[model samples]
Target chain A: MGLRVLAVDDEADFIETLVKRFTYRRIPVTAAANGPEALARLDREDFDVVILDMRMPGMDGLTVLQEIKKRHPLVEVIILTGHASVEAGMQGMSLGAYDYVLKPVDFGELLEKANKAYERKKLNESRDHS
Target chain B: MIQDEFGRLRLKLIAITLAFSFVPLLSLGLGLYAKFYDTYTDKIYGNLRNLVDNKKVTIDMFLSERVAQLSNLALTESYQDLAGDAYLERIFGVLQLHSKSFLDLQVIDQNGLCVSYVGPYQLKGIDYSHEDWFRTVMAKGIHVSDVFMGFRKYPHFNIAISRREGEKTWVLRAAIDSDIFDTLVRTVQLGKSGDAFLLNAQHVLQTKPRFGHDMFDTVPFPDIPRFSGTRVDEITVNGQRSLYAMTWLNLKDWLLVIKDDPAEEFLPLYRARWLLILLLSGGALLIVGGAIFIANGTVRQLIQSDREKATLDASLTQSSKMAALGKLAAGVAHEVNNPLAIIMEKAGWMRDLLTEEDIKASPNFQEFEDAVTKIEFHVRRAKDVTHRLLGFARRMEPTQENLDVNLLLEQTRSFLENEANFRGITFVRNYQSDLPHIESDASQLQQVFLNILDNAIDAIDKNGTITITTHTVPESGEVDIAIADTGKGIPKETLEKIFDPFFTTKKVGEGTGLGLTISYSIIGKLGGRIKVQSDEGQGTTFHISLPIAV
Candidate 1:
């Protein structure tokens, strides 16, 4: 199966841009514009990698990221933010976020962080199954 | 230069008024001398003319009256008795009674022999035929002699009368002293160093003090013709040029001339005129001073206003420059953040795909994992840097919350400890016991600690030690955090500028120089203060003070 990715953002333009970039990279991608939408998507479909915006309208990205970690511990989550605070980065990472990226994001660097996070998650999952 | 416009103008006015006050005094002095001297000379000339005319008329009337009286006496019935040898005393008394002005008298025959002589002569029966007046009287029966040398060499003018005595003519002569003429000439008062003289139609000095010696002397003729009207003439007399006024004494057939050394006679007038000129000059100086004061005041006001305007303009420009920089930074941050997010997302998917069984069994899976790990680590670091960039650009308002600053310091220390350990330096923490919580943006406080750590790391060599200390004061109600590094410290000159943006000790590309500046701004926004102490070769320490939350 193709690599699974979940992208969450409060900005539609940002989500659309990410979807385009992911499509170009031939990565399987799903997107949500807010925290509730992101949670609904997470409940219906299983993703190998989840990217969440740290600042969201309702049930902020950090909360959704925590829920993802709790429900699908095998899935890796990456947080996005237009205003990337160090405290939020630390908090996200402590809550099992794969990594955090600031907005107007560099896809190449984000891809690398996401891939490493996904590999770590896969390893942990396989390790549990074995 | 900083004075107001009116104040400077006043200064210039004072300077100009003092300068031009004396010009009119000089002109007035010269003008007074010119006018007074001319008038003085003219007055003296008029008086001299009157004296000469008066003397001539008196002398003429005296001689004519005496001749008439004596002729009448000779015509009297006792005339023969008086002519022949009657009483000499009685004759003299009668003649003296008839003519009081005659000083001496003589009677001579037509044959030029003196028959009877009056009192002073004492010459009885003396011959007088060769005398000029005698000859003239005998020939014409009446004669008047010009002034001549007489008794005691005194200047005298005489009138002679002759009458027929049957076959011979009897002549009578009277002599008058020129002293009376001298006295009359003296009465014609001249100005200082001015005098009057009588000049005949031929322009000779007569009836002057030296008239006896200079009776026939020629007058010192003027350079220009003497004005016939009541006007003055400037002339040269006795080798000196003087202002002179001349008038003809018609009765005396002489000219009255008055000469004044104009320079002396007008001296007082000149002095008074000079005083007036001085006053006028003072007025001119006042005008100039007023002008200068006004000019200075205007120029000063303009310059001061210009200086103030320039200062205001410079301040506005500085603020605008800062504003422009902030906007540029924000725009740059917004553009950069989106791309970083995509990179982090795609990298995770790749890492997951590579770890699948099929990919892992492939010979290149191990290579892929290593490449992925390297990319991931660096990508994570780049994301951190970008996050800091955005934080600096957005200028986000601080959401201060009550937090334990010691805990935050411990967390930051834990983060940097591993890195310091790799560099052979040990990190030490000095947390104050019973530290209080302060209101602050926790993450920004972390960034401030991190920036301080970064600067300390750059300053130190291997084996350098960094110590972090935290303290709270109950009395001051503030928290203090001090980070000290036993490393090659910053130079003293650059210590103050350490927190200025783009000022750095590191070489190009190694440090952005924005770290300390951003940290300073963050601390400032939190209502805290940061201070540094350092010695060039010893160590450096940064102290941060924060007020306790109310």
Candidate 2:
């Protein structure tokens, strides 16, 4: 019924702020500092949407996105990048990411995209059940 | 420095050319001239020797004939017949009728008493018993005397012969005219300043020399080697170099000498030599001139090509520098964006906290809200810079799409149409109707066109035209777009750096200077070229050529 989110980034302050903002909106959110930790978190708990930073210290966002798509086929991924690379965005989209967002994005816009991604996950899960 | 290099190159070329051409020319010319000189000298000597030999034979024959005539007269005439002066006079008259060289004739008895005399002066009883001619004839029976003035008061020579008659001996002597004889010996037709004469054993002129010597005048003669036939020699006479041929006459102890100034004798050879020298020198001059001319032309071309290469190298270096800086800017922007994002998020979270009622009632809430707002605003500005840096880096591959350049240009022009009108600038579009579509990124090409059009609009002070023309090159399968502006054109120094990132001629804060750089990169990625031509006051034109899609 509510949006459950995972905010993954190597930048602790950025990730902490993102988590606090999500918490302020009353969304259930978790945090991971790296791609491996994000994948570990995804494996333990169910998340509606994953806001994954494209560039991370270990196991970049695209790899995590692939692993998530392979394991949890119903989970939506939104790629966040500081660098605006259309090619990476295209690759992330091809890898079944729900959306790609550049850094310094407004929190409201990020929330809107995450909500849309969660809706898509619900739609995907409903279609699977049917 | 470049001029000095090229000058050295030109000189080296000229030197090599002259060495190759002039050396052979001089050697060949000198070789031919030496060979010709040798042959000509041999010919001249041979000719002079032949001439002298012929003249010697002639003089010898004349003397022998005179001796033979006198001996005939002595042998045929009896003592009684020649004893009278009248009979000897008649015989001398007949001898003169045959050859007028005889000046006088006389009949002398064994005592050397002159018995009869005929012609010339009065010498009817001149005693000649002790004279050289008389005594020599008494012993030798025939004698020819050297030129002497015996009772004749002038230069003369006598030939005498003895006749034996019944235990008595008589001598007949005759004087030969020296003037007539000199004329006979001097009949050589050598060149001007040539002299022919007869020199006796005493080095006295027996015949008058054609130049200054008189008959019997003592003359200095060169010591000639004894030879049987005619000999030719080079000698200096009167301080002038001359070639002479000498031969001994058969009948007399006289040397036949034919002397000539070699400068006159070998005039033709000298002339030919001069002509050869002239030709060789003229040819050398021509070769030198041609070598210099060709060297200059080749060096000019080399200098021109080197200048073009230097320009190309500089531009390539600039391009690589821009590319490296782009990468560096992208990395820096990307790095800064993380912190910026954290700031933006933290400020936004604070703003979110301010929305709660408990924090909104605090006394510092407005200040905190204002401070957070300022932080967000500055973050936005930082984000704008990072975005521009990422754009400049151009790490993303362009999305390929079918693009109609004319339509794209029209759309791009529309973006600046309002600004152009406000600035009193008119857009003149000259689109080729049948232009082919090209394979390129539509958005990227639009960006390039918009940038150029925007620049064109900004360039104008007021009241100017921006002309955009497009045409397809059938051969290159490319479409050429030319954008020209009648504005205060870019200065030459600024035009070359226009495509360099952050190099701007605009005043501070007026431009980011990345429009042309981004445009250049975009066009380069699309397999196109951008070129600019500008006249400082006249205008500027930007030409962009894009490859057509297959």
Candidate 3:
């Protein structure tokens, strides 16, 4: 696979735009709006990395990241927040997120962070194989 | 319930105004009495002197014309050379008619023999050389005798004249009755109980007063030197005080004396004056009473008005406090929500991972534990903040309970120490070890300490020291806790209203200003007191004293 990524957002337009950007870049994108939906999807699917928004309508992005880490321990989560509050960012990192980013997302930064997350997943996979 | 400083001052003003109006009334009463007495005394003395002078002038006019007519009749050649009984009779008749005040008229020859006599009992040839009037008339040709009992058994005075013409001498005499002086005495009318009398040159009473006996004998004569003018004197007459006024009848040499009983003469005026005084006194009393009544009424009204204003102000303050509490609640809710979301997220993550038996056996439990610990920290932080917020927001009602005052203080200080450290403050605790337990609500006392601590921390910029000391005052049955800070002090203008709700120096979103208001209310409900001492550029100190737990 070129790349396996999960993009999470509460806003439909932002998620759609993110998914299209990933698709054009020849990367596979999996998406969920909140924590429960993300956790439900994680049970049936395997992805290289998970992207989640910090603020959401219900079962916020941090909860989704937590659920993703618990279910798919090998997968990496990149946090996306609309307002870059220092305390919120700190909270996401404390939750074992790979990295945090602000929206409207910078595609180059997101691509780099996602690439880094995918490499980390590959390293964990290869280590397990050994 | 609202009788405060302003009401007490208004009551004092009413009392002062009531006292102030009494002085003028007393003065007015005294003034009226003085005026009335003065006016009456002046009138009585004025009229007495006028009548005496008029009588003297009438006597002088009669004496001068009679002398001139006698000389003209005696000096005529036909009348002087033929001096017969007929001639003499005509001359005597003219003299008698001219001097009606006289009692007898007589004529004597140059040899001092009675030439002619007229009137009731007269001798035609009686020898008159032994008489003083006869001898004086022969020598000076005109004579007047002192008052004496003369012919016709009358007390009289004589006017006599001698004439010489063609070697023949003629003497003419006219005796005036002493009772003629009574005319002057009788005419004087003193009001009500006053008397006027006539006295001779010898100071003998000539006429009796209308009231009784002659005052000349019964009354003390003033010991003034005999001077020829009007005089006023106060004398005691018949055991009563009297005003004696005298005027000399210059031509007749008589003393006109007026003895007036002052009380009777001025009785009407005095009584009127007394009535005026009484009326004035009454009016003054009424005015003073009215003023006192009005002032008292006004003060009562003012106190009522002030109480009403106080009631309105208290209600307004209470509502404003409630509004502030609402805002505090909303703000606290928002602050707490952030931490709650984080804790929920991390716990959810842990919950999902802990379900696998193999994962629990793995060393990853350490990683799970670390996450769980962080989640627990946030949850605890949220709970603490919410608990403090709720305690602060709770309305205070009067409730009594026994409490360990020093322990409560120490616990509060420990609770705030982390916050103080976060603000770079050094909080020192100096609690008395032997303090007695105080009665108060633990929540309310804690809120009071928190509010003071918050203010102390806020006052400091950085590196400030906050010192709290607690002690049990055994003698006063109170526990005093003093919280002091070495920070930028409150300004003088803002310090006065620091306890008032919504009055804050902190900028928007920094302070709600209800901290001290709530603290003050809580302490008041517990029968405790809170006081603040602040100086600009120095620091602020709050002293709280709570009644002993009972």
Output the number of the DockQ-best candidate.
2
CAPRI docking class of candidate 2: high
Deviation in Å, model 2, residue B64 alpha carbon: 8.4
Whole-model lDDT values for every prediction:
0.70, 0.86, 0.70
lDDT of 2 by residue, A1-130 (tens): 7989998898999889888989888999999998788888988998999998888876888888999899988888998988777878888999999888889878888999999988888888889899
Task: Show where candidate 2 strays beyond 4 Å.
Answer: B1-4, B53-121, B126-174, B179-195, B198-255, B259-308, B311-315, B395-550
Interface RMSD of 3: 13.0
How would you encode candidate 3's per-residue C-alpha lDDT over B24-121 as one tens digit per residue? 65566667666755665666666555655665465555555555555565565243432466765666666566666655556667776766666678
Which sections of candidate 1 miss by over 4 Å?
A: A1-130, B1-146, B150-152, B159-174, B189-194, B201-204, B210-229, B233-243, B259-268, B284-298, B361-550
What is the Cα-based lDDT of residue B472 in candidate 1? Answer: 83
**Candidate 1 lDDT score relative to the true structure:** 0.70
Clashing pairs in 2: none
**Pairwise lDDT winner, candidates 1 and 2:** 2
Clashing residue pairs found in predicted model 3: B102-B175, B102-B176, B103-B175
Candidate 3: residue B216 Cα off by (Å): 7.9
lDDT of 1 at B175: 67
